[model samples]
Target: ELGLPLEVAVLGVLESGYDARAMSHKGAGGVWQIMPGTAGHYKLRITDKLDERKDLVKSTRAALLFLRELSKQFNGDWDLVLAAYNGGPNYLRKMLDQHKKKTFWEVSQVPGFKSETLEFVPRFHALLHIMKNPGEYLFKIPEMEQAEVFDVVRFSENISFDLLSKYAGIPLEMMEELNPHLKENEALAQVNFYLPKKFGNLVLKKIRKYYAKLRLEKYRKKTLRVVRYRVRKNDTLLGISKKFNVPRGRIKRYNRLRSAHYLRIGQILKIPIYRSVKSRGRVAKKYRRALSRKGAYRVKTGDTLSRIALRHGTTVARLKKVNRLKSSFVKAGVLLTIPSTAKFQPYRVARGDTLTGLARMFGVSVRAIMRANKLRSRHELAAGKTLLIPDQGS
Candidate 1:
């Protein structure tokens, strides 16, 4: 650790109350309230997926190093250093030159200095004093509990915090609390994951077991394939579903479409196709049995005979003939018999499947699979993880 005044630690209290995720209106982030430019200067990563300014250890070290540099610049003047840290060093130096002041106390009386910067140093000192002498301040602090120890585990591949928590038997909330800097559900590769000290070995063992299972399942299991299709002029969801021999609901789900009427021409949709593998026959049998049991569907609002027929893989004529309907219209809460068709299937991802590759192989778009799974990126696809495949033709 860089040797500096013990009082410097209290700056975090004044800055953000030690909240790693604390952000200012000025776009400063983390416990130290580092600005974006400062974070960039310190080489902290800031991306849509990652913002290292919220990383406790990294941000603290950067802040301390920054304080050290400021100390040297102000010639060991802690007051000036604190002032410069609040306002920019260049601004503080400019104020000093204009007012011909040698110390922060002298500069404080000048009108040109920012009020926030002028008050920052004093507020820090006040908090430091109050913390030092709580009895004098009438503050009855509760007895502190022994801090929970943590062990860091480094990963070379991307994995979800959900999986890690499950594997380690740690609560997901606790994991998120411990690692607040992880912005997404999936932790990126080459990052440190902190686990409770007692669960470190257990997490490692479970993760290894998961990887081993993935390797074994790669050659032994059949997975769902994805296909992508672009909407054509005047294309409708029902028409597109019929063309692909997939259900309309599945199309909406895969593409994250909120309504059937919102389709735009040239919009690409992901279509999940069930590939014919040698192992698929057994799965098909089980799937058929399950589908047979689902024989009735209750009519809902906006239900049309054609739409229901398209969803159930039947024709309007077949539905009308079977149900003995006099009209094409149906009311909500009416039960109709449905002939069984293919439903969504769950497929565990294997070692070699890339999102793009899966899209290509199944004739679906990468965006479709991502939308269906609610995945932030393709990187979330890990081996031994199950994905729901939208059913194609029976």
Candidate 2:
């Protein structure tokens, strides 16, 4: 409907091999291999949690609109538009102005034409040619398979796929096969989940059950804070409890960890820290200033105050003094207010210091490093930049 040639869709094939979620090293993503900047220009939503560039139909429509606009800009020269799409229009225009090339064919011989752009038109032409005359090329194309019919189910909260598979009566393998758009073990909130048409009723029924559990009155309270902890190697329930200054029994009850044996590497545990008036009342007025300067810590699977103090450039004595703690005993989900000192320490990022390595070295979680630095997963840690290390559990 965009008044473009049918053969123009071949660019999609060349760009992404028709993979909707295809992403290039240069951050070009989706079926049309649109860069973030181009996707923004076309009004595609791109965020850490959501990327609409991978929506096949929307991306195709956007691609068509962009191609049409480019065609008009190049004065109906589809070849030049295609070339300009491969190389930038501005770069091509500058080359044209410098070399006095009136057409794409003339520009192709010019030195300014990129090597990749030089082959782009020919590749598109070859794809169109092959598609038009498959027999002439001695190629026998396979019939396209029909797409599976599925019903869309939206979840407002993040729920693990294991729970979803069990409750919805869908096999875990089938869920994985159907939801290729989802990352491995992801439980993204407020997203549409595609299920087989037959299981629509089951999915809806389970959705209610799933959400009913989340409607607890305690969860609605603003005073409670939740932290996520991933169990690292050789992590124990006792060690984790001591690190956060909470009871081990409460930790087991909160996370539903029946036994210490159930603890496994990379197992994510939810740590709930209560921040109430009672907890705050324990600290003295003089210590309140220390608490004010302190960073909040949500205990993780294997954290210790020694490690925490080392990471934050503080001492255990100072931590106890600041928090007015009677003992070093901590729980996994308990929030510990670590007092900050006059000597605020910031660690400079060094070469080969990845987030994971730093987390392990500092006895904190990777998420803690991210949270402390206000960073997202895609953010790169440049060497020599100071990163504020949180003095407690993540």
Candidate 3:
């Protein structure tokens, strides 16, 4: 019955305060503080170009889907849902069983969890109270007779948000407020634009008119139908499939992968969710930013998969292929792409390596290096490789 997106946002505000970059300092980052491993479960790209976790809109969608499952596990109690959302469902399940309290109220009294989770219920109730009749809490949103969220559509190329604001006659500041699914200033750079149900069609028309270069596209939003699996000492695809009511073939397909030997500790997989809502998008030429695929990556010295994927929003697998890598084995200065962006630090000039040689080694132009690094002097190479080698960061 609680199908309203607004109601979901209300809980997210309590979970992450609606900040996409909210990280837990427990190595958690993004509005949801989604750990890298857990995020990988949803196939949320850890690539360099874009951090989907920092993407408020994408992350919120993921969070909502996650909450739906938690609700079922906790038997529809918002209190238990909150606890599970914060502490994870399995942790709560174990505690609930140990406490002998049939309901969330019973589990709240159980010992040994973070204090934030312990205090979650009362806070949620108070917040919900304030939301239903905001006068009590002084929270006011301009009334919109009903709460129907916008439909997200993809664009072909990056467009400035300012242009959209000018067209909509709405303040640029209010764009994200209206569409909580976008990154800050993402409307213009966004290949995907979300518009209110009634208003989306109108906005699409206007966008096509002014931006003739925009092409129509089909878009899909990422969902949160991720599986909850803890890395075992030695679990394989078949092992996990047997544990979670999923088929091995289905898991391989979503991951765009073929190998079962590569999984490591803390690796969580997003089992194909048979019963979750799908995110659909129509593409326009103007929304040209391409979505990345997942892949494997080996660690190189002075290398981090996160940094590699950050530049491209790409995962690690594809990074290796772009670099023509044969295996995960890597040494210092081994260049590899994680899974995300296509940008990376180029090979820096070494003590004896000439700039021209370095460029030739990486199949790039010396002039490009000069321009890329803003180098004015031809003799400015530092003894320890001064050139920044590039990689198609995941």
TM-scores, all candidates, are 0.55, 0.49, 0.40
Please provide, for model 2 over 44-135, each residue's C-alpha lDDT reduced to its tens digit, 9 standing for 90 to 100. Answer: 77766556577665567878888888898899988899988888788888888899988988989976468988999889888888987889
- How far residue 366's Cα lies from its native spot in candidate 3, in Å, is 50
Q: Which regions of candidate 1 are displaced past 4 Å?
A: 141-148, 221-394
Q: Tell me the whole-model lDDT of each prediction, alpha carbons only.
A: 0.76, 0.70, 0.59
Model 3 segments beyond 4 Å from truth? 1-9, 27-38, 54-57, 98-101, 136-142, 147-151, 157-191, 194-394
lDDT at residue 343 of model 3 (Cα atoms): 49
Q: Higher-lDDT candidate among 1 and 3?
A: 1
Candidate 1 C-alpha lDDT tens digits along 149-211: 887777768888888777757788877876777889667787766777777778878888888
Error of 1 at 207 (Å): 1.0
Those runs of model 2 whose alpha carbons end farther than 4 Å from true positions after fitting are: 143-152, 172-181, 195-202, 213-394
Comparing 2 with 3 on TM-score, the higher-scoring candidate is: 2
* lDDT (Cα, 0-100) at 115 in candidate 1: 95
For model 2 the local lDDT of residue 56 reads 61
True-vs-predicted CA distance for residue 291, candidate 3, Å: 48
